[model samples]
Target: MENFDEQFSITKTVEFIQKNKSTRVILQLPPKLLQFSSKIEKHLKKALKNDKISFFILAGASTRHCCVDTVSSARVFGDLIVHYGHSCLSSTAQIPILNIFIPTKISIQNIISAFETEFSTQKTKQMILFYSTEVENSISGLYLQLNKTFPNLKRTLLNLPKNEKEKVKKFEQKQEQEQEQEQEQEQEQEQEKEQEQEKEQEKEKAKEEEKEQEKEKEKEKEKEKEKEKENLKIFGRVLPITDITQLSKNQLIWLGSSTNPTLFSLALTFGAENFLVLDPEKEYLEFEKMERMQPMRRILMKRYALIEKAKKSENIGIVVGTTNPKKDLQIVKYLQLLIKNSKKKSQVISMGVVKSLKLGNFVHDLDLFVVIGCNESLILDQSDYYRPVLVPDELDLALNHDREWDGTINLNFYPNHDMIANLEKKLKQSFDLILIEQQNQKQIENLIISRSETRSFKGLETRLGENKVTKIEEGLSGRASQYQDEIDLN
Candidate 1:
């Protein structure tokens, strides 16, 4: 509530809503900011008088507070969502969102002074400056000051897309995609007509030429694919540095709250050695003298152990953490298929937030759970879950019987054609070995029949002898807050 007007642009939001003519708006606030929800809603309502707009303050988000709760908004038929607090700036949401990032105050001079004090004697060639979204406004100023003070050190700022620009670009990209699809349809029709006309005249020569051209194109495509695979293996949302292969050599300077989870994820992604944190609001250095290496090492060791355990898992559960209808859903389907082909039973379950309590119910059924979520959500504590939870890359490595572990961990849950093909190849190799083994055994059919007979099917006997059934009854309708069945005492 402090500096509410300066921190949150109520006027701009109102004007934008009026311009867009959004009737239903969902205001999503984090747990910490929930106290101010009523105040914010009242101000917005007062400003938008006679606009006939409804504001819904959504609490208890299913996903991380930083990520937009598009699923909840969609449930209420909200046309627009105004998200408060820190944000991951994920562009995968299905609805329009306005992110109002919390601003943190910090003195640029203090950060410069801290940097000078820490590395006064240590000679560092390159440094990568990472900042949280809360302190993004001050990052540029700090970068400028640091550049002026330390001219010898090569500095790089982790550049993410601007909030407004990212949304606009997403809209433009969608429009462009639609236009391209229409153009492709027209081109296909024209090409079909031309092909019909030419089919009778020079059929033999045209067929031969087309075959040769197709072969050349395939060869070129294969070459390009190989090159791309060799050059780019890095995926995930946390792309701090350009050449991530050389990340070990550079010093990492983080500008934001010390408690932010992103810092931990970055530390896990890269090594935590030579990492510094500057709390912008407090204007002081954290972890300056403390030991971060040991904690990071423990995390890596636990994750490595989990990966090893995941290989022996029989019943795997693919946990979808985000509401992304495209990428996350595709990953869930692909993972299920991959596990099935690998001769392991797998199940897909969707959740807004994955917790130990929620997963405890499935502990008896699943041996391990593979989490497909945002970069931050991928890093779960070892003690949190009863069973081992592995990321997509970790699961991929576990299922891969031949690949050797080189102490590299990837948090990429995005859909990649190469990853799928590689896993499929490994599964096929295993299947071939199984086939050879089956050929050597004469009682394969009998063994399969015995295993099938042991399975239980109680559904066929659960029905009662009587054919008459009860009449269908109406259920609760509308939103949970105001169900149709609730009686009005007033």
Candidate 2:
């Protein structure tokens, strides 16, 4: 109950501990491995035989690399931290951290045999292999062997495509171009010269040149579109999006697990049928396609609805919740510029941690709140709080026409200099999907709360928000005069 059944390099951990000679170290692990922290603590203590050196286990809720415990470790005066259960991010931590992911050992020969048997029947035109960094070693040989044996398989990473504003701008440009083409045609039709025969010959030559030029322009536009469809850039290593064109419409792309919620969200956004999961942890190599991506569609719908609400908001509050102020100052300035551009009143607010009770204190002063999260995304469960709390990217979705939500519903607002101009980020999974799962967990009591129950759509009644496909809850729709539909709401 207190030790992990999984095998890892115990000697390496011992070497790290010995080399550091850490007097006070913290071990942070995901929930499943949290129970085993105590056993790990004892083992480390016994191996070093240094009673003076202490090992403390973190007791905070940590799910992924995004929500790192560096701040938590610092608060506890931890000298070092040993993180477990996920691949380490390239971003440096505030303190030294040793990432010990859950390692699964399987033979390359056995894995390929399973792969040949299970994956041979797939009618996929092309194959690409991706491995999560944590278990890269477990499946790396397979990747190489597949390359040598199959030779046709490609190695690639996913690139996230363009945002909404880019599409809109292109559309406007095309419209202007078409208008110019019509004007040119009208000008060509006019005959100013009295030499009718020579004018006709000259006009025909000009028309032929115009047609050739138009054909060339069309070809150039097509080439540009193809390039755009292939090039997509993504942030950090987690769930970077890919241009769907570079990916085959008829191919089966396989991803190795260390797959978590972020990958799940990405799989849905990228088109589930186009991708498959190759989990080496499973006894047999079974690649399966994700069938459900509707949750992402729902999240997109809710976020866009929120974007509409933010556009009309008069009293806006910016919640600054980052641990690093120096790096985040620009984001604050950016928010101020955006708010100024929108011509709305704004007040900056900060609480060490954002909670409903704290946010409720400003209910009278603010109509909408934008939370500034640098590393960890702040997702306020509005199960109790009524006012909408949005992150910076959602604000861009509302006020800035140049910036658009790429359906990357991620709440974390780390201002990468490159992404500053284009806020192209997505969620690990829809917050609604998370809430839906939470509601499902409470079903033993026969109570199931819908994800749509938390958000109020009063602000979404405008034409901009009218693309909504989901229905409003019956209670909120003024179905009954007394609002008798209310029975233990939330």
TM-scores across all candidates?
0.69, 0.56
Give Cα-based local distance difference scores for all models.
0.72, 0.61
Clashing pairs in 1: none
Q: Global CA lDDT of candidate 1, please?
A: 0.72
lDDT of 2 by residue, 420-464 (tens): 443222122344577889887778445334545665763545578
At residue 165, candidate 1 shows an lDDT of 45
**Mind giving the per-residue lDDT tens digits that candidate 1 earns over 34-61?**
9989998888888889558999988889
Question: What RMSD does model 2 have?
Answer: 27.2
Error of 1 at 232 (Å): 10
